[model samples]
Target: MTYPRTRGLPTTRRTGQAPRAGTGSGFLFVMATLSCVIALAGTYYFFVRTTTGQYIDESALVEAATLNGPAERASTQFLDWLPVISVVIAAVVVLFVTIMRRRWKAAGIALVACVAANLATQLLKDWFPDRPFRGVQTIELNSLPSGHTTLAASAAAAVFLVVSPRWRPLAGFLGGTFAVAAGVSTLVNQWHRPADVVAAFLVVGAVMLPAGWLVLRTGNRWNVQDGRGDHWASSRLWALLSAMAGIASAAVAVYSLIRIAPGFGQENSTTNYFWAGVSLIVIAGYLATVAATWLFGVSARRRHAL
Candidate 1:
């Protein structure tokens, strides 16, 4: 079956030369992946290895546990199943898109990204040295990038990548929300800290951005879809909402951090840091989603131009 190509991408004008759809997208993907790697390393250094970061992370864990009760217990019961649910949903979505659109290349790219992201998470967890006894009584082994968060984020990202551009903004918004929730739930359960979740977001982005560009580079025709005023999922409203939510969360986190700065190490209350960490996770997740959606959209347009 011949896959319908998007008219937006340009082919050879007269000489019938092979398409160069990958040119601009290839550069963008490289830059984006490098940026994510830098972000991940920086997060590991500042949050996982440093004294201040450990204090804050430990404090948040304490606060999160304290905040955990009947409501939290109920939440964990459901959250524990998120990885399985995410995998199932992502598998169904990826298979459907691959079969319906006959986008075998896209399917393979998504699968590779998912596996690479998760594998990277586990490797980082084991390879990174334990944190020095930073005056904080906590486990020494580094848990900077969380496994569960990676699972959720990568799965959600795979689905986002497989879907047509028209559906991405909505998928990004909803998928970001799900991933963030799963990250935050880990916090509530005292399984991982906020920075861990944030790092997970970066890892998934690092892996997915390149994979997404590959899809655009290979499946350009099927990847590009009419997004303007098409469906609710394709609307700009979702993008706007995601941006608003990210901005708001960042502002709140800054304010919380400022308030806690005065008593940074001496404070007994975990409330401020807990919320602040959660805010950072929210900001990272939504912003990454928005960036991914925008990258694919721009890459598609540029491919058409080439």
Candidate 2:
């Protein structure tokens, strides 16, 4: 079916067409915003009304450290690797889209949005420094707005925008799941309060939703244009850059896992399970990229043959 063409943009033989808007954008924006605001409010209550910000005293830290033993180590290891995995996934999505569509602009915009979400999280943390700990205590700044969650969610949203409509729901679900998992893990490990995760979600959603909308809208506009499109001079350069980003993110995840749980790298253990999961995810991502490339290639060839 032919879609409506948007007016005022530069027209190519293929330009001016606009696709039907998807429902995902509105749904994601509303749900993400609601979840984040609720989390922030809860955090505010804890910090203002209680001593949640106080650090465990030295003696308490030593005692708890001793009692928790390997469990603490395991939790730390998981958290460290989790962010790395999220980042790698995001990078892979960016690279896949760029290579298949030669849409470097969209990929760059996604990367920037991810970075901005993290930055926004940090700024919010500093702005609201009220911890809400519930144990033997010393005093320090509160850790509201979890950066890990923000980055994961923002990256997911950005990537979702560029995917084919048929794949969007699955992409969005995976992205949201990763973000939630990262946030929940932080809380479980005592690295972040419940409130912190909520705040992070809010900050990430606020930044990503609007940014995603604009990027997708522009991309749709471009896709409508007809011609031997002007290919960007640095298309290959961008692809390589995206691959590098993916590699770097994977490395970071490995480093984080090692730092959090040194034993995680040991052979034939639950740590292996985590590593295996990440590897599978990476493999799946690459396969998807290959498929997308093949499909795009086939379509291009058919058009030429016609």
Candidate 3:
């Protein structure tokens, strides 16, 4: 069945009118500035005071770090490989936005946002330079804003702009999970305090959300087609397949986690197995949903061509 494309209410665009300043770009700029200011202010508060003003604290970090050998190893592995995963996720968002929305502007804006966030984090770190590692007591430089969290949030915003609105909830959930994991890992590893992680989340969110909103608004104005037509069977099938793949990947990841860190739970060996099984099943369902949607789009296109 042919599905009618939904169009938004038309707005006037005069030739002499300055090209509509990208809402996403403008919003990103504002957020980046705000995050930088906050990071700087927090750094000053921690360093400038005569007495050691602990602006951020991570009491739980000590507990998290004292995990059993297996759990500690697992966490280490997760942290070590996190940067690679983040880069891959970012690449996916850029590619999806470029292909689906045909919005080079939005992609560029997202890239800029990522860069700005990273720079801001780095600058803040430099400003609040942590003392050289002198054992557990050594305080590290300004770790107020987490670079990993920033990357995750920016990437998530980019993906949200490219994907259909129906997928927003899933995108947001995945993004939030990544951001939280980044923050938690840093805290547990004693690389950053809890306040730093919290600040990072707030800073990233403040920038990303507005940037995404702008991208959506500007993208709507451009009249770009995402190529995913509403062919019920095809769409459903694609979503199912994509979701299945995602689930499978997630399962593999979880299994690897368990194998690498078997001592995570109590002596009851069955608990780990149970949780792994549950995780696999849940991830599989999510993957299946995504696969079905993607496959359905492919099917629709093929049929249209025929």
Indicate the TM-score of model 3. 0.55
TM-score of every model versus the real structure: 0.90, 0.54, 0.55
The window of 10 residues in a row where model 2 has the poorest summed lDDT is 53-62
What global local distance difference test value does model 2 have? Answer: 0.51
RMSD in Å for all candidates: 3.8, 12.7, 11.7
* Model 3 CA lDDT for position 98: 84
Error of 1 at 297 (Å): 0.9
Which 10 residues in a row give candidate 3 its minimum summed lDDT? 9-18
The lDDT for every candidate, in the order shown, is 0.82, 0.51, 0.50
Candidate with best lDDT:
1
CA shift at 158, candidate 1, in angstroms? 0.7
Error of 3 at 155 (Å): 2.5
**Which scores better on TM-score, 2 or 3?**
3
lDDT score, candidate 2, position 16: 35
Regarding TM-score, does 1 or 3 come out ahead? 1
lDDT tens digits, residue span 1-306, model 3? 333332442222332221232322443445544754565466446433323334113223343445457655665677787878877887877787688868786777667776666676667667765534422343555565667655655555556445544454355446545665565566555565545655555555445545554554455444223344453422344344445555665766466446536385343332333333224323423432343233323322322232
Q: What is candidate 2's lDDT per residue for 127-223, written digit by digit as tens?
A: 7755444664534575666677677667776676566433443464455556655654554455654445556666765666555555644564333
